[model samples]
Target: MKRSPMKPGKPLVRTPFKRTSPMPSTGMLSVQSHQRTAPKRKAGLKSKGPVSTPIRRAARGQDCTLRLTVCNFDPDTTVLCHSNYLADGKGMGLKAPDTAAAFGCSACHDVLDGRRPRPADLSLAGLEAAFRAAVSHTHEILRSMGLLDAAPAAIQPTLEHP
Candidate 1:
C-alpha cells in the first residue's frame, strides 16, 4: 500500500495499474465490416418486424369488452390488453399479439394482469370464459372499424343523375 505524503498514513485515491501483457488483437480491420453486431436471438425465437401498433392505438376511447364486475367502463381508460393465455402466445417476458387482445379498462386490465383480485363470484374458469368472449367482442369492433383483415367490404353508394 502506498501512503499519502500529506497524511503520512492515508493511502492515495487510486493504486497505480500495472500491465503484464500487451493488448490482445483480432486482426487487421476489414473494409466490409467495422461496426458492432447485435447479439443472436435465443433458439426458436424470431422477430417478424414490430407488433401491430395501429390496432393498439385504435383501442383508445373504445368501450371495455371484458365488462367484468371490476370493469370501470370508462372509455378514456380503455386500451388493448393482450391475452394472458399461453395458447394465445403469452409467455414469460413476451406478450400475446394485438390480434389476440381485447378492449379493456384499467380495472379489467388489472384483474386480468393479476394486479387486482377478481370478483368473489367469479372463478378462474369463469374469468377465462369472460376473457374469450371479450376477445371476440373486441374483434367484432375491430372489424367494424375496418382495422382487421376479416372486416366486410364497405358498400359504395352510387348517385342517379337526371
Candidate 2:
C-alpha cells in the first residue's frame, strides 16, 4: 500500500465542487435602504384632527398657575406656559402623548428648552422629575375636561433610567 504525501491526519483526496456566482445585488442588502422607505399607512383612514387640539383644549380657560419649578421659591415670577419645548426641535410636542404637553411657566420652559441656562441648584434628573410630574398633572386635567378617558390606565413614560 502507498502512503499519501499529505499529513497523516489530513484527507488524501480534495473534493471537486463548482463555486456559484455571487448573489444578485438587491438594494435591500443594507438596513438603511429599508429604513429610508416610509411606513405604510392603514387601509382605512381614521382622521384624528391636529394632535395639539386635545392638549390645547385641556389647558384652555385654565390659568397656568402650575408650579413646575424645582423650588417653589418665587411664585410671582412664573408666567403662563403652553407647550413643553424639546431641547432638539425635531418632534416638538409630538414625541410624547398629549399628556406630556404640560403648562410650564416661562422660567421652567426656558430651562427645559435650553433657551436659558439651567440653574446650578437644579440637576437634569430633578428637571426630568418635575417634567414627569407636570405630565401627570396634565393627564389629570385632560381627564377632568373629558378630553381623555379616565377609565383607561395612563401610558407609561418611554424614557427609562439606567
Candidate 3:
C-alpha cells in the first residue's frame, strides 16, 4: 500500500484544496482596445455613419471613478489579496491593513489558492447613489412600458418628465 510521507524534521504534509475567487470575478471584463475618444454607435439601424454626438451620459455609466478597499497581503498565509492590479494598487509593498467597515483581514481572505475559503466583498451601500440612479432609470423604463404607475419615490427628485 502507498503511504503519505513526512520528513524527519517536518510536519506531515496536508494537501491543500483548490481555491476559488471570492468576488464574482470580473476577470473576463477586459479592455478590448484603448479608445482615444470612445466608440460611437448608431442610434438605429437605418442611420449610416456613427452618431455625431459624443456618448450620452447613460452610455458612459462606467466613466465614474469608484474606490475599492483592498488588502495587499495576508501575512499569515503569504497570499496576495489583490482583486485587480489597478483596483488593488500596482506592484508590491505591504498595505497598512485598514480594515474597511465591511471587512477584516482574515475574514476577507477566507479562500486562498483553490480552497473553499471565505471571500468578502464590499456592500453596495457604498454605491448608494449609483444604485439609486440605476433603479430610477429602470423604474422609468418600466413606467414608460405601462408596467409601473410612477417612478419610484426615491427617484422622484431626479425625474425629469414625471
lDDT of each: 0.88, 0.58, 0.34
Where is model 2 poorest over a 10-residue stretch in terms of lDDT? Answer: 88-97
Per-residue lDDT over 1-162 for candidate 1, one digit per residue giving the tens place of the 0 to 100 score: 697458776766765884455446679664544545999888757776656588999988999999999888799999899998899999987889998999999999999999999889999999999999999999988888888979557999999999
Per-model C-alpha RMSD: 13.2, 16.7, 24.0
lDDT of 3 at 80: 19
TM-score list, all predictions: 0.62, 0.45, 0.19
Error of 2 at 19 (Å): 59
| Highest TM-score scorer | 1
Which is the winner by lDDT between candidate 2 and candidate 3? 2
Candidate 2, backbone clash total: 0
| Cand. 1 TM to true fold | 0.62
Off by over 4 Å in 1: 1-52, 151-162
Candidate 3 regions off by >4 Å?
A: 1-126, 151-162
Candidate 2's residue-wise lDDT over 94-125, tens digit each? 44445456665556657777787877877888
Query: Which sequence of candidate numbers ranks them by lDDT, best first?
Result: 1, 2, 3
